[model samples]
Target chain A: MAFRLIHASDLHLGRRFANIPQPPDGNIRGRLMEARHASISRIAKVAHDRNAKHILLAGDTFDTATPSDSVVRQALTAMGENADIHWWLLPGNHDNLKDAEPLWETITRDAPANVHALADASAVELAPKIFLFPCPVAFRSSGRDLTANLMDIPATKGALRIGLAHGGVVDLPTAVLTFRPTETVAPGSIILRLATGTDVSKSAIAHIIAAAPNRIGSSMDGAVSA
Target chain B: MTLEGPGAPPTVEEVETGAFLWINTELPLLPNTDCARALEAVLPDEGRRDILIRVRATGWASLQQQADLRQAAARLGPDFAHFDFDTNMLGTTYDDADLDDIDKAGALRLAANRLKEGTESETLSAEERAVSAGALARLYAYVKEAAE
Candidate 1:
C-alpha cells in the first residue's frame, strides 16, 4: 500500500529571509521559504482535498533555536488550515531546542490531535503496512549520529517504513546531494525512508526524496533494498 | 574535542577546523565553564547525539543526519544551519578535515577495493567509495595543507 507524504525541510521561517526582501512572485521572507510554504500549503491542500493520511515535516520549520511568537503563530495557522490531515513536525535540530520552542508548543497547545511534534525517535504505526519512525533533535547530543541511535528501525516486515528527520546525510562528504542510497532496513528488505538522500547541501533532495519515491531522510546511513 | 570559553585563545586543535574565530590572548577567557556555555549556545541542542561537538578547532558542531547530512553546513558556512543527528549506519567515505592524507586516502582505497572484491561487503557501493574518496580527500587535503 503506497501512500504520499510531503518531505519538506529548512523552512527557516523568520530566520534570515535569504538573498532578498521580496520575490518576483510578490511573496516575502526570501523566495525559498515562501516557495516551500507555498508548496507545503499546496501539499496540505492536496492532502486535504485528496484525504491523504500523512504530512511529514522533516525539520527546521522555524529559523531560530528560539523561534519568535508570531513565527510560531504563523506556522500554526498554516498547519491549522489543513484540519483534516495528520500534520506532524519532527523537531529538526534547529527547531528542536532545549525547551519546546514556543512555536511548536503553541501548535501542540492549539491543536493536540491535528499537529503531532515528535521531538525524538519514536516508532508509531501510522498505517497497516507502514511503521513510521521519526528522529527529532529534541536536545543536545555530542559526538554521535542520531539516526543510528535507536534499536531496529525500518521494521522487518512492512510495506513501507519511513523516517522523517532534519539532518544532512552522513559519510560521503564530497557529494552534498544525499541520494546515494542508505540502509534503514536489513540487508535485503524492500524498505524506504522519505528523504532527499539526507544531504541538505544539494538540490536532488526534492526530486529524489520527495518526488516519485516519496522518500525522506533517515538517520541510518546504510543501504536498503528499496 | 577541546573545551573552550567565549573569547579565549583556542587550542591548536580548535584552530585546525578553520572556524575563523579570532584568538585574543589579551582579553583572556572568562572561564572554561563560561566558554563551554557560550560554545554550547552556538550549536542547536535539538538533536544532541549526531552533532559532532569538538573543541580542538574553534568550538563547532558538525551534524550527521544520515541522508542529506551536512548539506546545510556545506551550503552556508558559519550560518545557523540545521542538521539532523543520526548515529546509525555510517557512509563508508567521510573524513574530518583534521585527518592526514595517507591515513584518509588509505581508508578510501581500501574500502573501495574491498567493495570491488565483494568480499565482506556492507552498505551502498562500499566498493565505489572505498577505492579512495574519504581517504584520498584527506590525503589531498594534507598535500594542500603542506603546500600552504
Candidate 2:
C-alpha cells in the first residue's frame, strides 16, 4: 500500500475582505484574510502528519483571480512547509483572475515542484507510488469543462490511477469529450474535486459532473445519496 | 579588537545620535523574533515599511521621513535589516467584479511597478525612480537613505 491521498477543495484564499476595490493596497478584512493561510498551513501539516502522500488543490487558491501581496506570501509560507507530500494545485476560475492581479502571475511563475500548477491536461508521476492524470484549469472560465478533456487521454495505466481535473461530465458539452470516458476511469481511480469558489453558479455546474456534489450542498452527510 | 574608527564615536552621547526605527508588521506570524522585538519596542512595525515611510502620512514622518529613517537605519546598521519583513502582499482581499479584464490589467500594473521600483533603484531610470519613490529625490539620495 502506498499513501492515502487527502483530497480537499474550494479554499477561498483571499476573499475575507470585500473585493479588489477596497483594500487594493492590502488589509485583513476580519480575521479571515489571515485564516486563508492558516487553513492551508493546517492542511499541509495534517497531510504530512497523516502520512498522506499526495495533496490535491482543485482550484481557487486565492479568493479572487487577482490576489494581493499579503495573500500570496501567506499561502507560500503555509504551503512551503510540507515538502515531503507532493501537492498538486490547479488554477480554477478565480486563479484565472490574472489580468488585474499580479500576485497569481508571480506565483505561477515561481511555484516549487511540490506545488505544481496544472494549466493544461497532463500526467504527473506523483511520488514513489502514485501517478496522477490531471486537467488544470488554465483560464478563469474555459469554453468547456476539464473532466471531458482529461477522460480522453490515450493511456490509463497506473497503480493508483487518479484524475484531478476541474469539472465533471455534466458541465461540458457532450460533443467535445475528444474520445470516451473509458480512456480515463477505472474502479480504482479516485476523482478529486478541487473547485474554485468564486460564485455558486460555476461550482454548481462542476458538482453535477463528478456526481460528487462538491459544488451544491455537497456534504459528506448526505453526499453518498447525492 | 579596536571597533571604533576615526568618526565612529567621539563620546557615548554622540553614539546616541544614531536612531533606530521600529516598524510594526501587521502579520499573523508566530512571534519571538528577537530583532523585531527590540525595534518594535520603541517604534511600531504597523505594516508595509515602504508604504508607511513613502506613502501614508502619519503623525510622525512622511516620505520626507525617509531621509531621517534611512539615516537612522544606517546608524542602526545590519540589525535593522533583520526586521525587514519581505512583504510584497502581506495582506490582501478580492471581490467579485475584478473578474473584468480592464480592472485586472490596471491592478497588475500597480503591483508590478511597485515590485520593480521597490527592489531595484539603480536599474530604474530617473523618471522611474521618481515615480516609485513618489518624490523628486535623486536615485543616489534615495538609495543612500534606504541603505542606512
Per-residue CA lDDT of candidate 1, range A13-93, in tens?
555534332425543334334443454566576565545667776766665677667667766677777566777777765
lDDT, each prediction: 0.43, 0.43
DockQ of candidate 2 (2 decimals): 0.01
DockQ of the candidate models in sequence: 0.01, 0.01
Q: After superposition, how far is residue A166 of candidate 1 from its true place, in Å?
A: 1.7
Candidate 1 displacement at residue B23 in angstroms: 35
Candidate 1 wrongly placed segments (more than 4 Å):
A18-39, A46-51, A99-102, A140-143, A150-156, A172-190, A196-226, B1-148
Per-residue lDDT of model 1, residues B19-102, tens digit only: 111111111122122433333445544433212222222322211111122333334223322222232232323334323322
lDDT of 2 by residue, B34-115 (tens): 3333333444343222111111112222222333334454444333212333223221112222212112457543554454
Docking class of 1: incorrect
The reply for model 2, stretches above 4 Å from the true place, is A19-28, A97-105, A156-159, A167-226, B1-148
Q: Label model 2 with its docking quality class.
A: incorrect
TM-scores for all predictions: 0.44, 0.44
User: What's the true lDDT of residue A105 in model 1?
Assistant: 64
